[model samples]
Structure formats: structure tokens, C-alpha cells
Target: MVSFIPSKQLTNPQTVLPEQLVEALAHETPLAFQNVEPFRRKSALADGSQKFLLRNQEGKPVAVAHWASPYAPHSVREAIARVNSAKQAVGASLAPHILGPVGHGNVQGSSFGVFQYQYPLSENKFFWPVQRAQITPHLLQFLQEVARVTQVPVPTSEIETKFAAPLQHLSLMEEVPGEIRTAAAQALCRLERGLWAPRYVLMHGDFWKGNVLLTQKQPPEPKFVLIDWAGSKVQGYAIFDLIRMAASFKVKPKRLGENVAAHCQILGCDIRDAKSYLLAAGGHFALNLGCFPLERFVCMMQASVKDLDKALAATEVN
Candidate 1:
């Protein structure tokens, strides 16, 4: 049976929960460890979900609890689905183990809550790279593994729904620039005819160094665990994830086209169609990741698309 945390009002400075609620969460949740205290809290500004880090009697970090209000049932359901999909795509070891909406009886009356074991402190602090240049080949390989596992064949008939809709929606958004819309329309034209990539893969939606947790126990071949899967998708443009990883790591706009070309190779898509992939990824970002109103995403697209030809052409050099 699954349990849930009761709906409670969060006070000011969203990250800091009320002391009384903290005490209740520590003892009432299913994985309720004894003598536990919350050391940190973060409230997702965009989604209103609350996160708490709890430690046990020995003063070692033990678990994390994530809570959402009953009013945001979609958020709770989506989070649960995304986490399960990630585990299936990347294996249980590479994904956090999510436990119940753990609570006492009256599950229907409670709000949504989930708990997960905390990764090792050292791994959290030092395992993942701090800079784009510091990203290791093994880490890249791990990302590839995630992409590889989630690939699914897309039938020609379903192309419009799966690949073209997002780009179409992006093209129609007034917030997007004219040239970007033109680029999206061109990509949509090809995708509508079933002419671009042949398969769709699950996208992490926000794949970045910060979202990845690395375990260095194996030395030189560290394993990774992904978290915060609230926005993950079972079938989306895979290149979006790759480009997001690069862009989030602060890769320059001009260099992003090159990264897109490389990611095409990784995903078994045609390298010659890298431009189409970039537009599709941009569309996904705008439509799916709530980047339509974000100027940074727009500027990045404008700059990258402006230099894309030169960048990709340069890559063709010996």
C-alpha cells in the first residue's frame, strides 16, 4: 500500500519548511528513520514541489523526500511516470530508488509524497565534473547508454504526432523569431513526409551535469544515477537531450551545431540532416521545456543557427 504526506502550507522562504512539519515528515513517512533531522530544503520555483534532505541518528545523510500538493495531481503523476521510465531505460542502478507516498492510512486524503535514498556524500560532491571540458569519456558513454536503451522505432504514419507537432507548435509561437520559425517549418515539412530520423528515443528533458550523480567506486569507470525526472518523456527528440547537456554545460552557441552533428552520429541519425535535428530540438525545448518565454533559449538558437553552416562545414575538414 502507498501512503502520502498530508497537504500543508509552506511558509515564506519556500526552501525552509516549518519546524513542526519537518518533525512530522521525519517520523511519519514510511522510510521514517529515527532521530532524523532535515539539513536542507529546496522548493522548485517553477513547479512548487518541495524537496527535503534528511539525516539519521549517526548524523549521516539518509534520504530525501519530495512532496507536491493535491492540486498538482498532474505533477505528481508525471513525476512518478518519468522516474519509472528512467529506471527502465537506464536500469535501476543508474536511477534513484523511489519509494512510496509513504504515510499512515487514509491514502486518498493525503497529498503526493515520494522518498529516495541519498547518494554518497563524496559522490555528490566530487564525482561529477564541474566544467564542460572536465566531462569524462566514461560519463559520455553512460549518457550514450541511456540514449541507446530508450530508442523506439517510429512508424511512418505516427510521424506527424511524434515529430512534427512540437515543431509546428513552435513555428506558430509569436515569441520565436521569424527565421527560427522558418527553420522549424522547413524541418516540419520533411518530418511530415516521414523523411528525417527513423526512431524516437526517450529524452531526459533536462539532462545536465547537475542532474547526474556519479559513483566512483569502480574507479576510471564510474557509474551514474539520474534524478529529478519530473519532466522526462518516453518518446521525444533524443537530440534535444544531447544538445541540452552540452548547452547546460556552457558550450558556446556556434559550437552547438558541431555537438548536434556528433549527437546525430551517436543516435544513428543522418549527419547531413544535423540542421533539421537542431531545429527539432529547439522546437522541443520551446514547446515541452517551457523555454518559449525564455530569452536565453531564443538567443542561443539565433546565434547557433546563424553560425551552424560554418560550424558543421568546418567539421567536414580533414
Candidate 2:
């Protein structure tokens, strides 16, 4: 069992940088710095790890260090090792950019890579900490990987069942007191046909906005590169990632469709695919809204219904 330290202890050293972090950064980056600072955090810290800013040997700002909390859950501790593993996998399989451990310990058992600084945003917010983006190609591989490890039903049926609850939740919201809405009108089109995520994927199940990084382009148009995989699981659905990816763009000031496109590309499933494999993703995300008011949840579903109707109409006309 991983030794436990209370989370309060992890956040106690508010100012002085961690020696472990300094050493870890030295191994990851080329910059040289002599000092460090505190990195602002959010209730945003997932998995109980604390974040900090640090300087390198050359006196330059280097990285955001994450140290594990005391009394950290075993899952959180295991996440740290798993995140390193995911980084190594992505690094070996995809190259050009590099990975740096920004937060340490159990913030969802992962690290946010440096490449995430380029996410699309109209303004800076206090709690934004994503470290990467999911491009089309990367997304497809992720889909297959998630299918590989889940070890459940086939992609199509599994995705449908997983998404059933969320779809119904949204469906219920779409239906008027006595009216049959388009989503409810159809027999859950995706449900009948089912989606295509692999039966199991070596996946990052808890992958949320905070865990992603989008890769940037040559001119750097606020693009991104994804990082962090401490909560990555192997048995998730491709749809869940898309839902989270799409949601990440929710706060963005522009180009909602285009952003969803990026996520679509990653999954290799166009938005129009009725039998898409992302039902699991949709349901997974609905679960994320548990903290919100029930009324707000209905509003979100209504919007989803409108979007789904438009997408279907377009597909049918095309």
C-alpha cells in the first residue's frame, strides 16, 4: 500500500518550491533557472495533489510541480505512476514535442505537460490548467485503446448502454409535457444502431478538460497539445472523451462547431454518425453534472437536443 499523507500537508508549503519538483524539472526541460514561485490552484486540483511554480538552474521559470498529498488515496498514488506510463507511451508513439511533469503526486494520478499552454481561449481564467489537445489521429488511437482495456461488451452495444442513461436524461429534458421530440421521436437512433468504440481500450477513464492538451500549429493560433493521464483508464468509451472535449470548449468565446470538429477528428467518428461510439462519453459527462442544479442539467440537455436535431437534419438533407 502507498503510504498516506493527509492532503492538508501537501498544500502546507505554500511558498518554498519542492526539491523533488526542481530535480524532476531539471530532467525534463532545457531551461535554467534559480528561483521558484507559488502556482495558483483551484478546487480544481483533482486527486488531491498540490501545484507549484518553480525556477530552473538558469534562473528561468520552468514548470508547475505537483506533489502528492499525504493520506492520498491508493488510486491517486497509482495514478502518478500511470501518468508517467501514458507520457512514455505517447512520447514513444508520437514525437516532436516533449512531455514535462507539471503537477506531481495524485492530482488524478497524472501530469499536465507543458504543451497545453496554447489552448484556445478568449480570456485568461483563474483555474485553467489543461495541458494538451486531442487531434483527430490521436483521438482515433485513443478510441481503439479505450476499447482494448474495458473488457466489456462489444463497442456498439456497450457504447449504447453506457450512453443510454445520459441520452434518456437529455431526452427527457427535450420532451415537452406531452410532445414527442425529435430525439425521443426516433428510437434513440444511435441506440438502435449502436456506436463503434472498441470493446476495451487502454484508456484514461477520468479524462476531463483538465487532463487534455491540444497540439499547436506552426503559427500557434491558440492551439493545444494534451497532457496528463493519471486518471486515464483502459475501459472507457470514445464518446466520453468527445463529450469532455466539446465541453472544454464551452467557455471559449468562439468557434464551437470547429472545436467539436477537432474532437470528432480525434475519434475518427464524424458528428453525423448516428451509430457513433460516443454514447458512453455523453453519459459519462452527464454524470459530471451531478454537482449542478437539476434545472441547469435540463437546460444543458435542451441545448444538446437542439444540436442533435440540427445535426440529424443536416445529415438527412446531405
Query: Candidate 2 residues 26-140, lDDT tens each?
Result: 5544444444455553322355555555555554444455555555545334655665655554445442222444333322333422211323322235433332232433443
Model 2: residues >4 Å from true position, as ranges? 1-33, 41-47, 57-59, 71-77, 80-223, 230-234, 239-279, 286-305, 311-318
Q: What's the lDDT of the predicted structure labeled candidate 2?
A: 0.43
Give the per-residue lDDT of model 1 (tens digit) for 1-318. 322233333344444454455545655565644333332432222465445555555555456665565456456556766677667766665444222234421123323444545333133434434423454344455556666766777776876666687678778878778987887888788766656765666666666555654444343544455666777777766665655565455555456555656567666767655667667767766765552356777776785565565556666621
Instruction: Pick the lDDT winner.
Output: 1
Which residues of candidate 1, in runs, are more than 4 Å off? 1-45, 91-111, 117-135, 192-194, 215-222, 250-262, 288-314
C-alpha RMSD of each candidate structure in angstroms: 5.7, 8.4
* Model 1, residue 150: C-alpha shift (Å): 1.9
